[model samples]
Target: MKKKKISLGDWIFNIFLGLFFTLFTLICIYPFYYLIINTISANDISANGQIMFLPKGIHFQNYIDVFKIPDLASAALVSLGRTVLGTIGAVLGAAYLGFMFTQQKMWARKFWYRFTIITMYFNAGLIPWYITMRNLHLTNNFLAYILPAIVQPFNIILVKTYMESISPALQEAAEIDGASVMKVFMKIMLPLAKPIMATIAIFAAVGQWNSFQDTLILMTKPALYTLQFLLYQYINQASSLAAMIKNGTVISTSSLATMQTPTSIRMTVSVVVILPILLVYPFFQKYFVKGIMIGSVKG
Candidate 1:
């Protein structure tokens, strides 16, 4: 059989599509690039909008200033601990709930599934949640961030959907081998569900990493502050800036000339906050892509 040659129109259309997508990608990425550059560039240059794709005058002093904030390192440790523990809890809980929902013989499965789904669309507002947390004595505790969001309903549904697509024959074979429910889940189902598990792990990790509201509301103790909440406090406290000035903290006069140039500090703080997650993402990049592909097909 003679292979058909590419049509001119199809070639042109593809070329146009590629160019369009390239431009869109650049448009999306440039703002983050600009923010990164702006944070490192001199305050004067940033204020004048002279910094764009490149740093105008390189400086590490903003980062130094950020570090000098009291207990910044401790706050970072707290955030890291919370994120790790929360992600693990959520992934395990969601996976178990998802697997249970997938079982044909599970009693009242429809009622349980519907109950979980209802939580996805509705939430008891913040005050009521706060009151409940207080009643549970979770306020000002690390568990405040962990316990409330451990079983994400949407994640459960996603995992369950993925689980439902697994071959029934495989499950039956496991049963014939006299495997218990737990063994079937751990050995057979979990191995087969790696892609979705990876996806949920990433989602849960990122959500915990970026979470601020829960920490803000439930944790009032300074020692328990997560990175996000600590950064927020640093940003809000005029006294921090005033104390820096009073202590003769080595801020450039050029930076001080425009006191508000600490906007760059905000950008820098964001980069710092997200840097760990960025580093961790590449390790899971393959699994992440696989997970999305599997999820889309199953969902």
Candidate 2:
């Protein structure tokens, strides 16, 4: 069959939509591109804000300076450990809860779901949360970061949506074969829901990896600082260190002198901190897209 010819109005509308989306995409990506360029550029050029789309001069000194900072590597390891454990726990717990809520016979399911939903909008204020954490002896503990955010309501909601989309015939078949609810969930549903699980896992992983506020509030020891908290301290305190060096209070050798260029150092730290998430995202992109499309269609 011959294809229908495109009309002038359709062509005009398509051109307008393309230009609008292209402009939106550029606006979204320019900042990250600028950041990557500025991070590798010399600090002198970055400080002047002249490095926009490209670096004025190439430099790896910022990365070397970041390495020189004491406890950087150790703090990164601590953050990595916390992120891995917390993300796993969150994904598993949320998935189980989602599966449970998907069952028609689950008692008080509406009330429980409402309770979880309420948490999404309403939170106990910082002071009350801090007091509770202190009372529970979670302060200064790694659990302080991991436990509080383990079962986010948004993730639970996503999992529940995905789980509900599974055909009821599957569960009925499992039950007919003498499988209990737990066995059915573990053996059948969980395996089939890998796409949604992976999507949720990526979200949980990125959130935990970038978390800094919880560590700042719950952890007092410098040794327990997450990558983000360490970077925050570095950014906030670097100027004071630079001033000390200028006043001769702190001696600045060639290695130590690089501390003064924290503009580039901060950018480099951001790039480094975000690199893992960037690398992991492409692996999950297909799963994420599938999960979203499935949920949207089913809904």
Candidate 3:
């Protein structure tokens, strides 16, 4: 076989493409990297904006001091609890409802699907929503986080669109084999829909993990406080919190350079709050791309 030689234009375009993407990748990555380096760098250096592009005087004391705040552990536990439970509920609800909408045998399928989607575009405003949640006794309750977000209309639509792309012959074949709808859905639809499910799981998990407004409005108990909400409070009170930490912790001469500061506290908390999502994203990225691309094309 003969190899084809590249044209001058092709060679230049390839070079341009490589450089463009390299720059774009750095643009996306550098902010998080900036946060990381600053958080771990010496407090005085970070505060003075002297640490850029690389860290100086690296230390883990920022993380240690941030973790020392009262109720941080419990708040983190609550956030983790909501993220796991809410993601599961959201994925299952979206999958089941999406699958059901595809079935002609479902009672008033078109009407119900339309009704569900309508809620996506229309809202009764904040006061009514707050009143509604209050009526349901969700205030200051842990279930406040999970129950309200279980059935997201946009996620359902994505799931339905993805499932519709699957050949109906598969479902028909399962039915012909005397498989009940539940059995088919559990054993067949779910397995085949792993990509979309993974996509939805990532979306739900990020949403649940980063949620702050819900906590602000629905929860009043310290026991129910989420990590993001706590971070929010910390950011608003960064100076006082930093002062408190600095004053409370004994500052030995050796540790003075790495001691806490308002800027360091903010950056450290941001990193701590976002690191889990960053770590979890790579595992689901392949499925997320496949799911979103296919769903968009199918829709």
Query: What is the lDDT of every predicted structure here?
Result: 0.82, 0.82, 0.91
**TM-score versus the correct structure, for each prediction:** 0.87, 0.84, 0.90
| Cα misplacement distance, residue 254 of candidate 2 (Å) | 12
- RMSD of every candidate to native, in Å, equals 3.5, 3.6, 3.0
Off by over 4 Å in 3: 239-259
Mind giving the per-residue lDDT tens digits that candidate 1 earns over 168-190? 88889989999888999999888
- CA lDDT for candidate 2: 0.82
Ranking by TM-score: 3, 1, 2
Query: Weakest 10 consecutive residues, lDDT, candidate 1?
Result: 255-264
TM-score winner between candidates 1 and 2: 1
Q: What is the Å distance of residue 206 in model 1 from its true position?
A: 1.3
* Model 1 residue 55 CA deviation in Å: 1.6
lDDT of 2 by residue, 62-129 (tens): 77767777898888898898888988888888889888989889999999988987898998899999
User: Which regions of candidate 2 fall more than 4 Å away from where they truly are?
Assistant: 1-29, 241-259, 296-299
Q: Give the number of the best model, judged by TM-score.
A: 3
* Per-residue C-alpha lDDT of model 3 across residues 174-292, encoded as one tens digit per residue: 99999999998999999999999999999999999999999999898999999999888877776775676667664566655686778987899889989999999999999999998
Q: Pairing residues by index, what is the TM-score of model 1? A: 0.87
| Residue range with the least summed lDDT across 10 consecutive positions in model 3 | 248-257
The residue-level lDDT of candidate 3 at 154 comes to 87
